[model samples]
Target: MDDIAAHAALIAARRPRDARLRRVGVSRAGTPLWLLSLGRGARQALVVAGPHANEPVGGATVLRLAERVLADPRLTEGADATWNLLLCLDPDGLRRNEGWLTGPYTLGRYFRHFFRPGFREQPEWLPDGAAAAALPETRALLRLQDELKPFFQCSLHGVDVGGGFVELTRDLPGLDRRMAYAAARLGIPRELGPYDTLYWPRLGPAVYRIPPPRPRDLAAAITEAAVESTWYHPHRHGTVTAVVEAPMWGVAAVQDGSPPADRDAVLHAVSDALRHDTRVLKRLLARVRPHLGGTPDAARLLAPVDDYLLVCPGLADAWDPDTADPGRPLPALTAGHLTALGIAGRRIAVRTAGLLHQLVTGAGRDPSGALPELDGLIDAGCAAYRDDSGARWIPVARQAEYQARVVLAAFELAGRHGARARSGEPDWGTQAAVPMHRE
Candidate 1:
């Protein structure tokens, strides 16, 4: 958000002269992909940002981290590892969001300028199938992975609002405590609801594991994994993938501890909401069917909203209610998570609905009333998003700092975990308070 190119240059200028910046690959749009490397230790780690264009907070965080490592060799000092940080992985998509990067960031402005890579298009997800590294940017990352074979890979991402949390492939001991403390120090609450736990195991209050996707043979990959895909997790087993989900808003709400709603009621609401979303999407698609001739990546554009209505809810339904109950009088933070989900759901709807409106209204700078049946729905959704008072835009630098702290802790934890792993120690996934660094 804070001029990624300039920041990259700044890192290059300020970094210890021994640190090296190398062009790893290029994005589809010809943006040069770069990695800043330092410390040639035995172990290796890869930190990436801009995997999702909409979540550039991670990119800023990664840049800040480069500064920290360069200034104090001790940050990565004792931990014997080589680090390669890829700044802004999806610059092509990020550029699409640059309009709002310098903003009086309001709810409306953020969504209007938003665009996240779909599952199939995401670099992290693509490596699983026939289309491995299909995107030029993805190929660059894959090359980096092949060359580095990192013991850890972290994707920096921030959520719209809820609370701060982390998703890991294999649970690392004591990392949860570190994350909770990081959130506290940042003055953010840890999300308590099972929004994510519906899919992954809750390690601690806010920390979760990436839920393994439904059986790979579940007829449809997109439909199945749409809800909870650990595609990035198992890509290189024994390697850990860590994600930091910081919130842009929903600060006080996260601390709420109210009793939740009934499980049945939540399921009903989810099914009904998604079914409605699907139906509206179908109608909009039909209306604009003729106009979609040769639109680039139209299918990919539609995959997310389609998956939202069909596969996503089915996965939620399959959750064991006795063990995982996500619906409730969600504490302020939990409720904020739900509110964020609803708003995100509608963003997809609006994206498609807007296109439909454009087509019907002649789809140009000066158009007529093309929004026939969808007008009220679009208007109502906008009002609902504005109603959530928990929304606050955390400055990019603040978020980056918060994220940077978590990562440093992760590096130490992972180093300890790796050292234990090499010694044939018990899985750290379930262990607690073991020595942080055994090597």
Candidate 2:
């Protein structure tokens, strides 16, 4: 079976009873793109799916939730009910990155293999204008969303090789609580914060921004939803919104070295936070459902807060702030920004090229080279692993892959010429790391 059918079968096999499943679109190869719907209530519901090609869990989670909603008929009863659920929004990216979707060989491998930074220079993620301009998968989703006018919409995505962070359309004061709960319930511990240290004037609320693309194209416009989801179809009865992002697997892995007591303490704290936060959000959402007359909240449910907490500290740093501006054209990256990203299509492709050379050619340090500072970052990140694992030497083969990529990229960025000469193409056969299964 193809990727979609395999996923669809997984959903069907494990899916709850009341959920409805159907094909929302077809692939370029004429594959049927499926969507699962749960809950029958007329109240506006959600369009939650996996947005990034690399992160399939969100779509899985949404399908799972639909099953749950279908089984629990009372979930949408009375004034609290919302709209009908919309299934996985984008299957194309999912299909494209199906290798990672197979199962976790290593989380780090999953990220580096699909290392499509959000910047213009990022060949992987940016896509050719034709594909980016709204892949058949994306356009079909927009059409469905615009026609249905759901209450709320969320896309599941992830960013590995960085810190954990959550991107929300609007600030939810208690999101920290919900996140803490997810971590605590899952037995992981990692603080979430801004991705980058810099800020922009107009996009004041964001932590970091990617640089602009040089030849601005329609794909850029599609990414920048002006008034949230409303930009897609201004005349729609209600708004259509999105939160494009990647999931951070950092939350559940904080117990490697803690005393049993300390580990429990962190878990308990996160659990307690989640419990309260979930309750608050459920209540808040319950209140909003009736107001929209069965329409999704779109952008209405989010409450802006100046002191919003992030799920990961380094979420925003990967891409420069200047590039993220939908308003500005993608920038012509200076040799500097390219130098910063190392390899895998970020800045500094040259340096990263050199590192691959060393790995492939088995070379040593070059005389006139400036190695990437990624080594220092990797060292620091190693410290983090040790701290979290209590030096238990948890099998971080997954993390090792991530470290390898970082090291490889940095070495290349330092302009190690001899190494660069011998760099071979990346091997895409490796599997992505699955999240660790903890008891």
Q: Which candidate tops lDDT?
A: 1
Question: TM-score of the candidate numbered 1?
Answer: 0.80
Please write out the lDDT profile of model 2 over residues 60-126, one tens digit for every residue.
Answer: 4444444445455555453233434334444544554554445564432343233221222211222
Which pairs of residues clash in candidate 1, taking residues 3 or more apart in a chain or in different chains? 253-332, 253-333, 254-333, 260-328, 260-329, 261-328, 261-329
Prediction 2 global C-alpha lDDT: 0.34
Q: Per-residue lDDT of 392-432 in model 1, one digit per residue for the tens? A: 56676668888898888888887778788889988756343
lDDT of 1: 0.63
The stretch of ten residues in a row with the least summed lDDT in candidate 1 is: 430-439
lDDT of each: 0.63, 0.34
RMSD of each: 5.7, 21.7
> Candidate 1 vs. truth: CA RMSD?
5.7
| TM-score for each candidate, following the candidate numbering | 0.80, 0.47
